[model samples]
Target: MIDKERLPQVAYQVMNEVHEEEVDLLNRLENELSDEVLDISKVDELLNTLLEHTKEHFANEERLMQEVFFPAMMMHQGEHIRVINEMKMVVNRWELTRDPELIREYFLGTLIEWLMLHINTMDTITAQFITMHKGGH
Candidate 1:
């Protein structure tokens, strides 16, 4: 459960909105996983939804970075790639094992931690750079 208040805000509106969406998706997934009668299909669906959202979000950010000629584009894009790949691997594991505990621990712990740190660091820097480059838009 991500406390919205605790989330670090980025300079860009679009990025902030996407981060909110990401949090929402993860929260929903966590609720679904916490249910005792785990619906494997529902969890799978949410996971897929999150993955798709992440892809679109990252693509949008990458495009902005390119347009702005962001100096740290390579590092930021590399992080996105790494996160996406890890998500894919998790999805694959879920399909093979249907392990609720595995999903729960990963989502509630690892994923949330990673998201907070990423937003606080890489995303904050990227958004600031983009906003500054765009004359504070």
Candidate 2:
């Protein structure tokens, strides 16, 4: 479970709300993975949901950055692309192997760590930039 209090605040309300939603999805995924029976379908569903949500979240952020003409848009967008590819790889692996332990390690370790770091760094800076430039956007 993610500690909401630990999540860093951003200058944008929408960004913060979207991040909270992401955290909620992650928490739900964690719960699903922790089940004793290991429902492959549930995990698959959650993984898909998370991927879709992430894509949408990135798209929204990218649009906002574009609106503000954010200088680091390319770099931040590159990171988004990289993460999306990584997520797709994990989902494909899950489909092929259905390995609970592997997925658990990924979500609990790599995915979570990357998300936290990205939020603290790229997202924080981007939100600040947007807030500074965005007028009614």
Candidate 3:
């Protein structure tokens, strides 16, 4: 589960909403992984859901950045593209191997670490830029 205290303070309300949804999704994924039966299908479903949500979230953030003429928009969008591609690779590998342990490792290691770092640094900077231009609180 993500620690709320660790989340950056963003002035945009929608950013906070998206962050909350991400936290919920992460918690759900963690719970699903903890099940003793280790349902691969369920894991696949959760991963797909996370991927879809992340895509939408990134798109929305990108749209906001574009609307506000954010100087770092290209860089931010590139990061989003990179992360989504990595997620696709992970999902594809899992589909081929059907290895629950591999999925677990990817989730607990790569995904979580990337998300925390992105949110703490890139997202935080983007949100601040958007807020400044949009006159958001």
Candidate 4:
């Protein structure tokens, strides 16, 4: 499990809120996978929810970047797009195979790693830019 305590402090309320949501979703997925009898349907539902939330979160961040005229907006948005595309591919694989273990591996390995790196780097910079430009946290 990715320790929430290790997550970088963004100090931006909206970004932090979205980060918390992401953390909650990841933790919930991890807990669900720990069950003895894997519930494919429930895991599917959770993945869908996470995907939708991630889309919204990325959109919101992009909007904020535009509002603040953040210099790294394009690069940040590109990363968001790449992550979403990868997630879609994983979802497609899940739909075809319905393999709980595969999905769990993707979540624990690819998704979690990408998310942590993104939050710690891109998000941290974005939050700093917003707070600096917008004035006051």
Candidate 5:
């Protein structure tokens, strides 16, 4: 099994690359938003897809931590839960208000920015724990 610490870096790498795809999706929704042309169905699909991807990524990382007996697994997972909850909150807001600009700002800017930092810092530390558990393999 891969070490937990090393796994988060790999996760981070994959995420950084995939983020552009998320951005592209967001961009596709942008015009719809700005013009008040957003199809609620489309917005729902986009958010659902993004949420799914986020869940998958977190689960994969958590599995790696579990495999290696990473001590911080629960803490790491709690963070993931927080992210999920926040996304859910955003989804609820979007559903209630149907504010395209808010969705855009949340996903494209604040959300992405938060993720970049989370992956680089907290995730890197998680990776470090994995690496150490594996004797820096």
Candidate 6:
């Protein structure tokens, strides 16, 4: 597992623990790293962490859809599949480069942006749908 440490809250998850894994890494990077230990290993870990994050988020969203009998479920599932494929392609390229910095940069810049957009758009909808359909306590 990439980023053995739990992460900090980068996404807009209603749950706090959900953000812990990434938060831990943010803290670690801030404390450690002397331009030497920062190698492709970190990149590999972050990539794996990203893949895991994607999987978890996708699974949760799909589960919600299945429970709700969501109409746009197919479209959302398609998007999740596309995201996995796109990230894998990027990971494949980064793998060829053998540069941790490139991976870090990609994750920080592009991945974060893509993730935020997805969360704001798709994730938000899922959460709202679930909450609304649940008959509000």
Give the whole-model CA lDDT for all candidates, comma-separated.
Answer: 0.89, 0.90, 0.84, 0.87, 0.70, 0.61
Error of 5 at 75 (Å): 2.0
Q: What digit string (tens of lDDT, one per residue) describes model 3 on residues 85-109?
A: 9889988998998886776677767
Q: For every model shown, what is its TM-score relative to the native structure?
A: 0.95, 0.96, 0.91, 0.93, 0.72, 0.69
The digit string of per-residue lDDT tens for model 2 on 11-34 reads 888998899999999999999988
TM-score of 5: 0.72
Model 6 per-residue lDDT at 61:
66
After superposing candidate 2 on the true structure, give the runs of residues whose Cα lies further than 4 Å from its correct spot. Answer: 135-137
Please report the TM-score between candidate 2 and the true structure: 0.96
lDDT score, candidate 1, position 87: 83
For model 6, the stretches where C-alpha displacement exceeds 4 angstroms are 1-37, 135-137
Question: For residues 1-137, could you state the per-residue lDDT of candidate 6 as single tens digits?
Answer: 23423222322344234444544543343333336566557656756776787678677668867988877889889988987887788789888977556555665556656655665576667656766775322
Count of backbone collisions within predicted model 3: 0
lDDT of 4 by residue, 11-96 (tens): 58778877888888988999889899888888888999999999999999999999999999999999999889988899899999
Using lDDT as the measure, name the better of candidate 3 and candidate 4: 4
- After aligning candidate 5 to the native by TM-score, how far in Å is the CA of 93 from where it should be? 1.4
Whole-model lDDT, model 1: 0.89
In model 5, how many backbone clashes occur?
3
The list of candidate 4 runs beyond 4 A from truth reads none
Residue 42, candidate 4: Cα error in Å is 0.5
lDDT of 4 at 130: 93
For model 6, name the residue pairs that clash: 2-45, 6-21, 7-20, 7-21, 7-22, 7-23, 8-22, 8-23
Model 6 lDDT-worst window of ten:
1-10
